[model samples]
Target: MSQGLPYDKITSAYAGTIVYPPKGTYGPRMQQDLQLVLLHTGELELTIDGSRHAVKPGQAVLLKPQHQEYFAFAETQESWHRWITLDLASLTDEEQDYLDKLPFSMPIPEALNTMTDMMLALQNDYLRQDELMRSLGYSAFQMFTARISLTKQQELHPSVVAALGYIRQHYMEDIALHDLAGAAGVSPEHLVRLFHVHHQMTPIRYLWQYRVLKATELLSQSGLSVGEIAARCGFKTAFHLSRLVKEQTGSTPSDIRKAAWGTAN
Candidate 1:
């Protein structure tokens, strides 16, 4: 069966390596987004929806939305792992369906080396945030997903996809949830739930994050002043943009620009 996950957009992605503290435990709760965790050293014990899964080195776990999970380092040993968090709403229906079929945990002994390398690449590209690096990161994510999934194609809801396009096209405007819902031909309440399920955030939060991301790009690539960049990125003012940027990234606009230009501000 040439069942494969469809190629879907990656809205946002980041990867990190973590070492669990001795006797560390995480969450006896549910997650709102999709997560991929790859064990590199020691062992992790996961309880998913009441089922116990022992994740060994060279193994990975794919957790879907709303899945109740609890995790801890086994035998109080320090465990090293790499994890990626993705917005699943960007998936097409086919891709989401394929993802739904995969086992919660699987051994990828042969792919250990390749997977680790890809994770590192993704982390670097995300941090750099250049146009080329962003593109490469998206491609790397697709390849990583393909290697782990057994499906051939992924698809998103047509309306949701349409809404995404609309947001991308008009992100610089003062857009509202109702506007997006109208574009998708759904009620505002429905749109909120849809975003929550797929994007793991409300539509407004997504809009804010998108604006911030765009502003950062401008800060890095353009000679525009903070006010000019803020206007172009749809902030109410430079102050508004600066506040959000600092809140989200812990960096001021000047600092971001200075870093990009290799100058001290």
Candidate 2:
């Protein structure tokens, strides 16, 4: 089977969120488009062509086109979920087959929530989502699939997961090794060992890299000045931001920004 599709090539056609009432049911019928469902709360049992798959809270399921699909939501409470429809006509046979062979149930990637929030900040409503935001969301889908593939290769340590979640949420703030450990509910030494084992670096190194990554995004996507971007991304100053941005991307902040706007000097 194919490993996966090129992330940049997987564009999103439409995306939206839904909340189904307890025991809600839909369709022992057909789905015409390729869609991915991310369940945030409660449960979902998807019956596709006589195969039943249970999708729990924090899980995702990829619904392929031309399937006799059925959806059964939680019986006790409302179920919250999001769906992103892929641009199906653009996929090659290998890519389509790779998606088809994917498991029916997988955990909803944390990066999806982060990406949706980031892109949503650019476009206030899904109904009014602009092409640029949709493009960014498409990249997010690729990230989801890439991360899922990596996860399938190796299960992440729970402490690493917890620490990473905290970092993603608070990368703009002042963070220390103890703070990371506290978030992961581990001691400083244990957290460091875990990071070294999984990430091949210390937690602080990861935090700094994450800050630079976010700074790069803001530099490309927002009109914020270098200093402002630095402040928002937890860099000590514009110099720090530029230094790391150059180190990580081999391009200075202004150059990256100009390139993103198609006017690089």
Best by TM-score: 2
Error of 2 at 157 (Å): 19
Identify the runs in model 1 with alpha carbons over 4 angstroms from their true place. Answer: 1-154
Q: For model 2, how does the per-residue alpha-carbon lDDT over 1-265 read when each residue is reduced to its tens digit?
A: 1125543453445567789999998888788666678899988898999888888888877787778988899999999988767554476777777677766657777656665554444444433233444445454555555466457534778888889889989999999899999999999999999987766578888888678768977987899999999999999999989998766544578765664565522
Q: How far off is residue 99 in model 2, in Å?
A: 1.5
- Each prediction's whole-model lDDT (CA): 0.66, 0.72
* Residue 56 CA displacement from its true place in model 1, Å: 24
Ten contiguous residues with the weakest lDDT in model 2:
1-10
Error of model 2, residue 220, in angstroms: 8.8
The C-alpha TM-scores of every prediction are 0.46, 0.54
